[model samples]
Target chain A: AQSVAQPEDQVNVAEGNPLTVKCTYSVSGNPYLFWYVQYPNRGLQFLLKYITGDNLVKGSYGFEAEFNKSQTSFHLKKPSALVSDSALYFCAVTHGSSNTGKLIFGQGTTLQVKP
Target chain B: GAGVSQTPSNKVTEKGKYVELRCDPISGHTALYWYRQSLGQGPEFLIYFQGTGAADDSGLPNDRFFAVRPEGSVSTLKIQRTERGDSAVYLCASSFGPGWEQYFGPGTRLTVT
Candidate 1:
C-alpha cells in the first residue's frame, strides 16, 4: 500500500521567512510523490512532483520540495513566505508501477504566513 | 485548453435521496479520478477511470457509491441513500495518462441533511 503522512497540523511562519511543511510516505515500491495546495473554496492546485530525477524539485509560486528517499520524506519548502501563500498543503504518493493513478493522500497541513 | 470541470457546484439534499455528480474531463485526457474531501481533511480517492473502463473502484466506501464513464470523456458519480457523513466536496481530476500530474476541478459541495 502507498500512503503519505503530514506530521504537522499547522505551521506558522513570518513573512519573508522560509517555510517548511513536512511530509513522509510509505510505499511498496518506488514512489511517485506530489504536493498540492488548496485555497478557500477552490480546487487543489498542483505544486510539484518527484517522479524520478534530482533530489530537489522546484514548483510554482517559488515553492520546492526535497525528495529524500532514505528518509521516505518529501518536505515542501519556500525560500520566502508571503501572506497570500497561506493555504492547506497536501502530500500524496502512488506506487511507481501502478497504472491506476490512484493517489493516497496525507492528512493536510495548514500553512499560515503571518505578516 | 479548459481544465477538468464538474457540475452542480453546490447541492443540498435530505438523507436517503439519490445524488448524481457529473464531471467533464479535459479534451483528450484518458485518465479521470474522483475524490471526496471533508472539512479539515485531505481528499480521499474514490475511483479511477481509464478511457471507458474503471481501472480501480476499490476506494469507494460502499455499494451505495457507484460511478460510470461510458463514453470515456464524461463521468457521473451516483450516491444512493445519501447520509450525513456523505457531506463533503467531491472533486474531479484528469490527466493525459496514468502516472501524470492531474488537473483538478473546482469540486461540487454536497450537503446531506
Candidate 2:
C-alpha cells in the first residue's frame, strides 16, 4: 500500500518554458523514487532520487526526472523555467521490499513560474 | 553540518493545552523522523527513530500522540488533548542509516486555537 499520485493542483509555466510536474505510483515491488522541493517558508529540499540505474534522473537546481516503468510515471522536469523556479512540488514513494525509510507522499504540486 | 533542527519555530496552542515539539538531528544521523503537514498537504509520516528506539509508530494519530528519542540526538514530540485538528506543520527528518536520504527541518508551526 505505497501510494503517491500528484495529479496537479496547479501548474503554470512561462519564464523560459518547458516544465512539467506530475507523478504517479502505487508500489508493490520495485519503486523508490523521490523528488522534493518547497520554498515559501522553507523545509524540504532534495530534488532527486530513483535508485537503480537511472531512468534519466538528474536533480538539484536544474532538476530532471523521468522513470516511467510502463508509465507508473515519475515526471518532474525542467528545461528552462525560472522565476526562481517557483516552488512546492513533492512526489515520493518507497518500496523494493522496504528497508523502512518509510515515505509515501504526494498531493502537492504548485509550480507557477511566470515572468 | 547542522541541518535538521526544529524547535518552537512558531506555536500557539490553546485547544486543550499541552504541547512540546523539538528535534535536532544530523550530527551523525542514525535516522529520526516525524512528519505532519496539512495546509495544502504533503508531509505525513508521524514517527520513526532508529537510534533511541521507536522503529516506527505507525503514523501516530491517536492516543494523544507522543514521541521521544532519549539520547539519540534529541527528539521530542508530545501532544495531549490539543485539538483543532492538532493544527499542522510539524516536521523533522534525519537519515544516514536505514534507507538513507532524508534531511529536513524548518517546521513546527502548530497553531491550535
Candidate 3:
C-alpha cells in the first residue's frame, strides 16, 4: 500500500535551534515528495517538492527537505527555528505510476518552536 | 496570481441534511482535487478531476460523497445524508497538471449536529 508516515506527533524546538520533522513513504513507483505547512485556521501552504534530481530541496520561509531514496524518507529541515514557524507540518507523496494528481498525506506533525 | 479559494468558510447542519462546498481553482489550472481533513489529521483524498471529468474517485468514502467540475475551472463537492462522521474540513486543491504540487484553499469547515 502507498502511504506517508510522520512518526512524531509533535516536535518541540527552542528558538534559534535547528529543527527536523521526519517523514517516510512507501510507494510502488518513483515517488514525487512534498512538504506542506498549515497555520491554524488557514489552508495548507506549499513548502517544497522533490520530483527528481537534487536530494536537497529548499522552500518557502527558509524551509528545506532532504529526500533519501534508499531510506524512503523526505524529512523537512530548517537551519534555525522561529517562534512564528510553529505550525502543523505534513508530508505527502504522489507516485509516477498514477495519472491522477491526488496526493497521499501523512497524519501530520505539530512543530512547536518555543522562545 | 491568486491561489485556490473555497467557500462557505463554515457550515453547520443536522444529520440527513445535504451540503455543498464550492471551490475556485487558480486560473489556467486543469487538474482539481478534493480532500477532507479531520481534526488533528492530515487531508485525505476524496477525488481528482482532470478537466471536466473525474479522473479518480476511488478515495471517496461512499456514494454519499460526490464532486463535479463541469466547466473545468470551478468545482463543487456535494454530500447527502450528512452524518456526524462526515463532518470535517473539506479542502480543494489544484495544480498545473498531474505530478505537480497542488495548491490548497482555506477549506470549508462542515459540522453535522
Candidate 4:
C-alpha cells in the first residue's frame, strides 16, 4: 500500500523567507510523489511531482521539491514565501504498478505565510 | 481550452436526501477522478474513470456512493441517503490518461444538514 505523511499540522513562515513543507512516504514499488496546494474553497492545484531522474524538481509558482531516496522523502521548498502562498498543502503518493492511478494523500499541512 | 468544471458550487440538503454532483472534464481528457475533502483534511480518493467505464471504484466509502462516466467526457457522482458525515467539498479532476498530471475543478461544497 502507498501512504504519505505530513507530520506537521501547520507551518508558519515569514514573507520573503524560505519555506519548507516536509513530506514522507511509504510504498512497495517505485513511488510517484506529488505536491498540491489548495486555496480557500478551491480544488487542489498541482505544484510538482517526482517520477524519476534528478533529485531536484521544479514546479509551478516558484515551488520545487527534492526527492531524497534514502530518506524516502519529497520535501517542497520555496526560496521566498509570499502572503498569497498561505494555504493548505498536501503530499500524495501512488505506486507505479498497475495504472489505476489512484493517489493516496496525506492528512495535509496548513502553511501560513505572515506578511 | 476550458478546465475541468463541476456544477452546483454549493449544495445543502437534509439527511437521508439524495444528491447528484456533476463534472465536466476538459475536451480531450480521457481520465476523470472524484475525491472528497473534509474540513482541515486532504482530499480522499473516491473513484476514477477511464473513458466511458469506471477503471476503479475501490476508494468509494460505501455502496451508497455511485458514479457514472458514460460517453467518456462527463461524470456524475450520486449519493444516496446523505448523512452529516458526508458534508465536504467534492472535487473533480481530469487528466490526459492514466499516470498523468490531473487538472482539478473548482469543487462543489456539499452540506448535509
Candidate 5:
C-alpha cells in the first residue's frame, strides 16, 4: 500500500532561521508528492508538488522541497522562517503510474516559529 | 478566477439524520474530489469525479455514503443515517484533469450530536 510518513510531530525554529519538515514515502511505481499547509480553521493549502523533472521543487510563500529518488523522500524547506509560516504541514503522495488519485497522507507536522 | 467552493461552512446535525454537502468546482475543471478530515489528521480521500461520472469511490468508508455529479460541474455528497463518527470537515477540490494539481475549498465542518 502507498503511504507517507512525517517523522516529526512538531518542529520549532526561531524567526528568520531556516526550517525543514521531513517526509518519506512508500509506494509502488513512481510517486507524485505534494506539500500542504493548514492554518487553524482553514483548509489545507497547496504548497508544492514533485511530479517529475528537477528534484528541487519551489512553491508558494517562498517554500521549496527536495525530492530524492534514491532515498524516496521529499522534504519541505524554507531559507528563512517567519512566525506566520508556522502551521500544520502535511505530506501526501499518489501513484504517478495512475492518474493523480487517492493521495496517501502523513500524520502531519506542526511547525512553530518563535519570534 | 473563482476557486472551488463548498456550501454550509458549518452544520450541526443529530445522529441518524441525513445530510448533504455541496461542492462547486472551478469553472472548466474536469476533475472533482471529496475528502474527509478529522481533527488532528490529514484529509482522507472519499471520492473522485471525472466529468459527470464517479471515477473512483473506493475511499468511501461504507454504503451510507453516496455522491452525485449529474451536470459534471456541481457535486453533492450525501450521507444516510449519519453517526457521530461521521462528524468531520468535508473538503472539496478540483483540478483541470487527472494528474493535475488540485485546488481546495474552505470545506464544510459537520458536527454530530
Candidate 6:
C-alpha cells in the first residue's frame, strides 16, 4: 500500500525565517506527491505537486518542495515564512501503479509562524 | 474558474436521522471526489466519481453511506441512519483526471447530535 508520513505534529518558526515541513512516502514505482494547506474553517488547499521531471517543484504562495528519490522524501519549504502561513499542512501520495484514484495522506503537521 | 462548491456549509442532525450533502464541481472537471475530515485529522477519501459513474467507492465506510452524480456535474452524498461517529466536515473536490491537481470546496460540516 502507498502511504505518506509526516514526522512532526507541529513546527514553530519566526516570521521571515525559513520553514521546512518534512514528508516521506512509501510506494511502488513512480510516486505522485502533493502538498496542501488548510486554514481554520476551510477545506484543504493545494500548494504543490510532484508528478514527473524536475526534482524541485515550485508551487502556489511561495512554497516549494524537493523530491528525493533515494530518501523517499518530499519536504515542503518556504524561504521566508509569513504569519498568515500558519495552518495545517498535509502530504499526500498516489501511486502510478494503482487506479485506486485515492490520495493517501499523512497525519498532517501544524505550522505556526510567529510574528 | 468558479471552483468547487458545497452546500449547507453547516449541518446539525439527530442520530438516526437522514442527511444529504451536495457538491458542484468545476464546469469541465471530469473527476469528482468526496472526503470526510474529522477534527485534527487529514481528510479521508470516501468515493470518486468519473463523469456520471462512481469509479471507486471503496473508501465509503458502509452501506449507509451513498453518493450519486446523476448529471455528472452536481453530486449528492446521502447518509442513512446517521451515527454520532458520522459527524465530520464532508469535503468535495474535483480534478480534470488522474495526475491533475484537484480543487476543493469549502466543505459541509456535519454534526450529528
**Which numbered prediction scores highest in DockQ against the true structure?**
3
Residue lDDT tens for model 3, A1-115: 7899999999999999999999999999899999999999899999999999889999999999999999999999999999999999999999877799679999999999999
Candidate 3: which docking quality band?
high
Q: If both were scored by TM-score, which would come out higher, candidate 3 or candidate 4?
A: 3
Each candidate's DockQ = 0.85, 0.23, 0.90, 0.74, 0.67, 0.68
Record all residue pairs in model 2 with backbone atoms less than 3 Å apart, i.e. clashing: none
Worst 10 contiguous positions by lDDT, candidate 5 chain B: B95-104
lDDT of candidates 1 onward, in order: 0.94, 0.89, 0.95, 0.92, 0.93, 0.94
Candidate 5 residue-wise lDDT, B27-106, digit = tens: 99999999999987888999999999998999999999999999999999999999999999999999987667888999
The residue ranges of model 4 lying beyond 4 angstroms of the native Cα positions read none
Provide the TM-score of chain B versus the true chain B for each model in turn.
0.98, 0.32, 0.98, 0.98, 0.99, 0.98
Separately for all candidates shown, the number of backbone clashes (residues 3 or more apart, or on different chains) is 0, 0, 0, 0, 0, 0
**What is candidate 3's lDDT per residue for B1-113, written digit by digit as tens?**
99999999999999999999999999999999999999989999999999999999999999999999999999999999999999899999999999988999999999999
Per-residue lDDT over B1-113 for candidate 2, one digit per residue giving the tens place of the 0 to 100 score: 67998998999989999999999988988888899989998999988988998888999989899999988889999999899999999999898865557889999999999
| Model 2, runs deviating above 4 Å | A1-14, A19-30, A34-64, A67-75, A79-87, A99-112, B1-13, B17-35, B38-42, B47-57, B66-80, B83-86, B89-110
**Chain A of model 1, TM-score against the native?**
0.98
All candidates: TM-score of chain A: 0.98, 0.35, 0.98, 0.98, 0.98, 0.97
Off by over 4 Å in 5: none
Candidate 3 lDDT for residue A51: 93
Per-residue lDDT of candidate 6, residues A31-101 (tens digit): 99999999988878999999999999999999999999999999999999999999999999988765655
